[model samples]
Target: MSDSTPGRPPALPVTFRPAHTRAVLLTAGAALFVVITLIALLLDHLSPGERVSFVFTAALLAGVLFLLARPKVVADEAGVTVVNIVSRRRLEWAEILQVNLRPGDPWVFLDLSDGTSLPALGIQPGIARQRAVSDARALRALAEDRSTPGDAAPPG
Candidate 1:
């Protein structure tokens, strides 16, 4: 949490993440990995090679869960960094046209000056809708304050 007011940009170097999602994914991944490995170790009926394979399978599942918890958004003095499941992008404030999180949207989106919109998965509404809305508003204010020209009205 930040000291900034509601709908206002927080201090620089703020990070936004799906806190509940990350916690659940990481916890479940660790638990599954531990339980599966223990079962593999305790099963005497299985051959050594079969136990090793079971452990490997558990590791693979845990890896996938780790990937599911990877999305995050980091905002700093230089710009905003968007980290999704498989891709990361850095954007200067001036390059972003608007930040949006419409109703029914899964996550926030950045409308860029290049005319393409980028999904910001870090601020997802799943399990934390209010937090996501606040985060989107703060990001939007930052984009409007830093990127929009002083003479122009900010976009909605």
Candidate 2:
């Protein structure tokens, strides 16, 4: 079925990490690290050194990275963009071969003509169901249209 509506712009497909989940995880990690550090500090007889402090600092830094490093799925008229913490990949509408909705999968994978798969990194099926489904439908429609008889193949 045609995915676009008469006047409405095609929805911007975005898979956002839930703020609450991020906050909870970060908070828990920070709390645990702090408690452990405090315990280490209190046991003076054990002679904790700079190494213990360094370990706690590293744990805190890791927690911060985890909190901030979430992915996003963005779609527009031109194509779809899968944005991760360190990189962003843009796939044009014509390049998308198919969109599959596998509910139990960790993330969505796009099947390309060259037998390679581009992952929708930001989309977590269990966490972002509705948005993922909407984007999948739109991508599927675009892929179908592009694969018609007269259309050109997408670039590698």
In order of appearance, the predictions have TM-scores of 0.92, 0.57
Candidate 2 residue spans exceeding 4 A from truth: 1-10, 13-24, 29-48, 51-69, 84-87, 127-135, 138-156
Candidate 1 backbone collisions, by pair: none
Task: List clash counts for every candidate, in order.
Answer: 0, 0
**Weakest 10 consecutive residues of candidate 2 by summed lDDT:** 1-10
| TM match of model 1 to true structure | 0.92
For 71-138, candidate 1 gives per-residue lDDT tens digits of 99888877899999999999999989989999999999999999999999999999999889888888
- For model 2, residues 1-156, the per-residue Cα lDDT tens digits are 114563333444533343444555567777767776767776766545664775668587766656454666666656777776667888776677777768676666788767788776555555556655655665565556545544556569
Q: Could you tell me how far off, in angstroms, the CA of residue 65 lies in candidate 2 after the best superposition? A: 6.2
Model 1: lDDT equals 0.90
Best by TM-score: 1
Q: Against the true structure, whose lDDT is highest?
A: 1
